[model samples]
Target: MRITNRMLSNNAIRNINRNLENMARAQEQMSSGKRVNRPSDDPIVVARILAFKTSIAANDQYQKNMEDAKGWVDASESALGMATSTLQRARELAVYGANGTMPKESMQALGKEVDQLIDEMKQIANTSYGGRYLFGGSRTTEAPFVDNTGNDKNVKPVIYNGNEANLEWEIAPQVKITVNENGQQIFVDAIDTNTGNKIGIFDLLKKLSNALNSGDYSGVEDTLSQFDQAIDHILDIRASLGAMSNRLEMSLSRLGDTQISLTQTMSKLEDVDLAKATIEYKNYENVYLASLATSAKALQPSLIDYLS
Candidate 1:
């Protein structure tokens, strides 16, 4: 309790420095608009902030995956639709050619048109999206269907070069969607149970083309049932793909909502209340100025100051 000018002045300087430190913190909050500028500022809140950020990062990746899945599904649906349309044209040609009034030359012309339709179907089976084949299964880099028949043959054979493996994407935690279907699933799986043969677009087109050229009018009519089956198959698969698109759209909406919620939580945890910080800064500044004033009066011209 030995009150001396030196002791009083030292204590006042220390108090001023402490007050300045508090004011600096307030100023920093105002400038940065963050309450927890450093981890030491609020350890618990900082920990929560980090966790929220981590969740947001993971969700963002899923969001991107959902987008990619949507793209794949849309491409597949479009390609399947085209394939169905080609099959329809082939069916109409068969019906027209089946008319007995059609002569040999007419049948041959119909056969030529059927050939073009088969080629179109081949192109569809080997369709690519974003540099990858939509129906190539997991072997997206390679064309799934190939023309295997020799040039001498009037009717060509098509070969499947892809597997039945499905391509998938993870749109959420533990949630996956098949983004692609193998060529076999779309074009080679529709078997005609009566004849124990696949009625898929490729096989049926070849048979129909052969029948038209050979002047087999009944044969043309026979392929109609098979064509209907193939179209039905494509429609069923396309419906499934459309459902996937809707699901992906829902996932995107949920991701948008979740991102917004996470961002709001993070803001609450880390952002400074500007009004509160401003008030605190002003109060600390006043206290520091008052301390300086008191210190000046107490230390001014004390006789002990000159002696020391």
Candidate 2:
């Protein structure tokens, strides 16, 4: 076979360029600690990495929703607890005021305390967290209960201005959580079976105050049964809050497990195996060095050695 200098030089240049390209690719992989920097590196691996990244991002969002749901539930539970305590205290005062043996002065003094408790309960019902009403159901941006006349003295005369909508948060596929409680249902619209009228806790407190101020012990006795109803109302609200707290805790646990699984799957898809990557990188380095040495030798003139 006849070989020309033009052919030899062209082949040498081609081989050197190929070897340098491979060396550059290996160096990039090593420096970035990634086997696939671009889709052209490995189309199949790039696709898998993209899918894993998407899943990771979705899982992150779900986790954030879970955290927000937990916070809202926690704040609601605390407010409900305070409201429950206020109801219990009001019930005690109602019982004390119902006693005919108690003097009018004492009954009037108890009315003052009951009125104070009414104000306290209103405060709890209007509790806000992060500039959002905790007990306002879906109306997080607005106050749940506002005084009818918008005055401090009439604060006990609160109205349910918020709607009975449930704030929903998605924790996973097909899994959602109600992150709010309706104050109207919890505090207002409580039915008194004896009168067939909806008598709320605030109304009962107001009646008690009126009865004590009039020195009507019998009227206080008649409203005593309503106090029991109010107690039951508080219990029911607390139970509902407890159930929601439990659901939130369960969702948090499941979300954590899902996040862990997603992390593992993402790692498997995109993370580099250091031991295998190091071995492959070393092999590519050796090949690149060998190619460089061979090209040098091939390009050198050796007429004396060839003749000998």
Candidate 3:
């Protein structure tokens, strides 16, 4: 079959169009720095890239949660430390108040000091972080320990309003950790392991205050062992908080490692090789230019030549 000038021109134009499209794709990849701009570029690779991006984003949020939990743990630890020291000071006062030779005025003065310590301990129990109580469990917005002692030994006293519940943070895929200690656990319900007595440090303080005021030497002396027991309980809780903090640090490290690995995988899936893309674009551009020149010369010999 004889080839017509129309047919030859149409074929060359079609080849040039395809070459132009290829060059455009290469240029886009070079400028955008992505191998796949649209889904049609390579559907499978695009899908995988999207998945990688989503995983990376979720991992980032988990990392944020880890940071938040760390702050909570630090705040709780500081508060517990303060409470422990306050108890120690009260113990020293108790030792003095327990002496039979102490004058009534001296006992009253110590009683006043113990009362002040009760207020201080209440403040510690109500420690807040980011406007939320650190020891209130889920009732973070409310004060856990309310001081209603009101100088009335016969009536109302300090009370813990919060329940014993754990507030947890999700630090990993399925792993969760406690970030706050409830008031009941730390201040109210601490038990004496040696005697099975459920006397808390706050209750011990109230009893000691009354004993000092009345010059009840026996009652005051009886408090030293209980105070020591309460101190030990606080130490135990503080140790647990420290252990959780260390675990959270490990989770943060693991998250960082996972994020790095995911980032590299995403780059492999979507990031363009500039050197390779630029070379390909030049190759397609040259082919398109050559096709244009060839088509111009081939179509120039028109049907009019045969007629002539």
Candidate 4:
């Protein structure tokens, strides 16, 4: 079949347009450094990128939760340490007060110091971080311990108003971690197994203070025993807080690894191979230039060249 001049010109124009379009697309890919600029470029790859983005966002939130948990754990550990020291001081005073040879004035002086320690303990119990109580459990907005009356009868008197609720945060899908501990259970004494009566650190301190003021050396021995038990209770809570800190650190490390892996996967799915893309872009550019040159030659008119 013989081809007409108009048909030849039309075919040449079509070829030039197709080559130019390819060159433009290649340039765009190279400039953006992405394999797929739009979903239409590769629907499957686009979907995968979307999923990776979601995973990254979720991981970021988990990391933030881990940070907040770490802060809370640190605060708890510090407060517990202070309480332990205060209890040890109180124990020493109790032992001194137990001696009958000590004068009444000396015992009163010791009582004053005990009163100071009690104040310090109350301060620790009411410790707050970022305007929220560290030992308040779920009642973070309010003080954990409140002194209803200011009298000496209520001097060491403080009530644990916090609940037993454990504050929790979700670190990942189906994974939750307790970020806050219940102050009532940890700082207060366990309910007596025999009598079912509740006792706490404050209750023991109150008894000790009363015994010292009344010059009752007989009750001093039992009060010292209770003080020892309170120390042990606080130590156990500190151990638990330390364990929680360790867990959060491990979780943070794992999350860092996960984020690294996700970033690599996202790069593989979306990032352009610079070396290969450069070569492809060059090839497209050559084709575009050749098509333009050919079209220019086809559009030119020469009678001698046509005859030849």
Clashes of 3: 0
Instruction: Return the candidate ranking by TM-score, descending.
Output: 1, 3, 4, 2
Q: Which portions of model 2 show Cα errors greater than 4 Å? A: 150-156, 302-308
Worst 10 residues of 1 by lDDT: 148-157
Q: Provide the TM-score for each candidate, comma-separated.
A: 0.93, 0.89, 0.92, 0.90
lDDT, candidate 3, 183-250, per-residue tens: 88788787563567576677888888889999999989888988888888999889988998898999
TM-score of 4: 0.90
Give the runs in model 1 whose Cα sits over 4 Å from its true position: 149-156
Q: Backbone collision count in every prediction?
A: 0, 0, 0, 0
Cα RMSDs, all models: 2.0, 3.5, 2.4, 3.1
Residues 34-108, model 4: lDDT tens digits = 989999999999999999999999999999988888898889889889999999999999999999998888888
Clashing pairs in 3: none
For each candidate, what is the lDDT?
0.87, 0.78, 0.87, 0.84
User: Lowest summed-lDDT stretch of 10 residues in model 3?
Assistant: 148-157
